[model samples]
Target: MVHKGNCHTQAVCAVATHLPARIHVILKEDRAYELRDLEGRPISKKDAKALIQREYTVPEEIRQRTRGHKKRRRRKEGYIRSQIRGLVTALQASRFA
Candidate 1:
């Protein structure tokens, strides 16, 4: 988790690793947690310090949309699997009938 001021914000970035060294570096990197301006360029040490001190909150709409997309994807995959299973069962029943 990234600690900002008094709040311990959970890391939202998807990281697929269990190695302690890599995890340490990722958590320690402040740039990953900072909300970048539209330009999306690397800033100097002075600028980075200023950005960290500022409080920011992600919009609720974005958080909800992200959750919706994930649920939709899982539902689609489940639908496809059920369709295939039903087809196989129907084929077996027709052959034995």
Candidate 2:
């Protein structure tokens, strides 16, 4: 049984085997980049920009429409963000430890 939260883990892990030993980082709400490892540890920003520049895939941008009467978009955006956060948390967990 797969949980919705860790959906990204399956994808990330599957690709991990094929990917080179590259560092993974995520953009935080504060517009800062942080290491996306098993501990959410901090890393030097010196090489972080290079990684971003070399990224192959870019995530789609999301925005809420203030003029829309329907709230579906807002709810969907929230749900997507929640799922992403859950995936990050799952990735940070130590399987061996």
Cα lDDT, model 1, residue 84? 100
Point out the worst 10-residue segment of candidate 2 by lDDT.
Answer: 58-67
**Residue pair clashes in candidate 2:** none
**Candidate 1: where are CA atoms >4 Å away?**
1-58
Off by over 4 Å in 2: 1-70
Residue-level lDDT of model 1, residues 21-89, one tens digit each, is: 665776888436343443777677777667655534444565665568779999999999999999999
Tell how far residue 81 is off in model 2, in angstroms.
Answer: 0.4
Worst 10 residues of 1 by lDDT: 1-10
- For candidate 2, what is the lDDT? 0.52
lDDT per residue for candidate 2 within 1-97, as digits (tens), equals: 0222223466588678755433222222335544543355565665555555455223332112222424777888999999999988888775545
